[model samples]
Each structure stands twice: as C-alpha cells, then as structure tokens.
Target: MVTRIAKCTCGQLQIVVEGEPLGVGVCHCFACQSRTGSVFAALAAFSPDYRVSGRATDYIRTGDQGARFRFRFCPVCGSNLYHTEEGEEHRSVAVAVGAFADPDFPPPQDSVYDCRRHRWVKLPDGVTVYEKDPE
Candidate 1:
C-alpha cells in the first residue's frame, strides 16, 4: 500500500493516509463553494484507516438535504483539511486534494452538482458529470 501525507497550511495538522484513495471527485454545490471559498472543491476519499495527528478544529453544518457535515481545519492557519458526512458508510473521509501538493495525483473521476457549476469553470475531459449526487 502506498502512503501519503497531507498537512495543513501552517503545518499544525497532519494526516497520513494508507493505500490509494477509494475515489476522487469534484463538488460544485453552493455549500462546497462557501466552504472552500472557491468555484469548486476537489476531494479524495479515504477509508477510516487514515491517521491524523496534531491540533485541528471542526465546524459542523447541515447541508441542503439535512445531512450533517463535519469540516476539520487547522487551528493555526485555518486551512480546511478534511470532512466527513453524517451516516456515510465505510467511515469515509474526504480530504482536500490540494493538501497533498502533488501535481501527479490522479485526476477526479466525477464532477457533481454540475447544475451549480460555474459556466466559466472547465471540467476535465471524460469525467462522469452529475447534476447532483449520484444515487
């Protein structure tokens, strides 16, 4: 299994993920835009086997579907590092792909909430596009 380290902007929080991610995707929902302060968020999903170290803070918010999301950020630099959704199976946690700072990391396989995606934002070719979350 390959291992990768993801760290907060100030290096105050670090996470070590074992093996490749289960999936990678992009989200363009309003909530994601607000949380990321960007047009979209690129995420890599990992199972519960990942380990986190150092100090971090969490912000809990309810989504449009009434699903709760817990966002974890660095206490020092306030960089959003990862998040977990309520009742998600496999104890999956979605981490900010930017945290890895690896240009060679695999591209996202899915782009969701395309309905809210900015008209100027260009998605990579060949990704599965969803108007909303895939059921």
Candidate 2:
C-alpha cells in the first residue's frame, strides 16, 4: 500500500498513485522515441484511479498498431506525464517513470518494440523483451 508521487518537470502537475503499479516497462518504438525525444521511454502503469492536483493537456496520436493513444502532459513545462490507449479495459494509464525522480522506484520488468531499440542501448539482465507489443 505504498503511495508514490510523480510530478512534471516544472512541478506544476503532480499525480499521486495509490498502492502498487500493475506493470512497468520500457518502449523503444520509433513513436516512443519521437514523442519522448529519447532512445526509449520508461513507464509505470496504474489503474487510472490516481489523483491529480494540477492542470495538463492531452495530445492524441495513433500508434503504429493503429491504436489511438491520448498522451497527457503538463501544460507549463510540456513534460509528458501519462497516456492511455483506446479501448483499454481498466482504463490503465502509464506514467512516465522519470517523472517520479526516484531511483528507488521499481525498474522496468519488460521491454517492448525492441526491433527499434538502439544498438547501444543495453537493458538489464533477465528483463522480458518483445519485438513488438506483447499483446
């Protein structure tokens, strides 16, 4: 029942996640790289029942798999905070792991879209990797 707090770069938007996350993963798809402007994006998924205490803006994008995703970001610093996929049961939301700024936070257990993974990027040992989405 540990609660974790995630915040945007500017600290204007804060989210409080209750209990534990359903899953944690890293995505190395082209879309994720472009959206995050990084080699990969790390996320911690929760049951969309968290509490938010600030304003955010939503940006919608279509994934390569043809699924629609709504990305939520802090309006002040434009830091991507969380996202939700279309038709997702439980309305699960994946929060940016970096937003927590806590090294103690659980690490990613899985890696997706590894086909697009950078050649130099090395994942920790024993992590489950997929060439594409696990689904």
Candidate 3:
C-alpha cells in the first residue's frame, strides 16, 4: 500500500495516490513529447478513485486511438498534474512522474512508440518496447 504524492512547483497543488501504481511507462507520442517538452512522457497509472487534492485545470484531447482523455495541470505554475481516460476494461489516471514529491521514484517498465522516440534518447535494455499501443 505505498502512497505517492505529487505537487506543483509552488506547493500550492498536491495530490495523494494510494497504493502502488497500476503501471509505469514512457509514451513517445508526438503529443506527449510536445506537452512534456521532452523526448517522452513518463507516467504512473493508478485506479480511478485515487484521492486528488488542490485545484487543477483539465483539458480534454483525443488520443491516437480516438478515445477521449483528460490532462490535468496546475493553473498557476502550469505544472502537469495527471491524466485520465476511460475504456471498456480500465478506468484510470496517470500521474506525471516528474510531479512526484519524491525524487527517487522508479523508472518506467516500458517505452511506447519507440518508432517515435527521439534519436538522442536511449532506453534501458530488456524493457518492453512498443511501436504503438498493442491494441
């Protein structure tokens, strides 16, 4: 039952996610890269009921699969907060790894969209890599 906490740069926004993450991974979609301003976006997915605190602004966007997803962020400091999506089997949210209050969070278990991965980024060996979502 490990709990993870995430906060904004000003500490004005905070959220507590109970239990270990459902999964951890990196997304190399162009949208993720652009929003994170990096090679890819690291994410920790959690169950839908995870407690969320502070005020967050949510923006909706359609993923490559055409499913609707929401991105939450701190309105003031613009810190990326989390993401949520609904589907047939899973309803969950993904917290930005960089927003974690702890710096020792584990690295991702997989790297998705390797075809889109930046030329300069090197992924660790043996990680499950995907050119895109399997489905």
Clashes of each: 0, 0, 0
lDDT of candidate 2 over 36-80, digit per residue (tens): 999999999998788888998999998776889989899999999
True-vs-predicted CA distance for residue 34, candidate 2, Å: 1.2
Residue-level lDDT of model 1, residues 1-135, one tens digit each, is 899999989898988899899999999999889988999999999987888999889999987667888899998998999988978836798999999999999899999999999999998899999999775
> Which TM-score value belongs to model 1?
0.93
- The residue-by-residue lDDT of candidate 3 on 47-129, one tens digit each, is 77677778888888888788878888889898887878756225677889888956678778988888998888988776899
Give RMSD to native, each candidate.
1.3, 1.3, 1.8
Question: What's the candidate order when arranged by decreasing lDDT?
Answer: 1, 2, 3
Score candidate 3 by TM-score against the native: 0.90
Q: After superposing candidate 2 on the true structure, give the runs of residues whose Cα lies further than 4 Å from its correct spot.
A: none
Taken over the whole model, the C-alpha lDDT of each candidate is 0.91, 0.90, 0.83
Q: Sort the candidates on TM-score, descending order.
A: 2, 1, 3
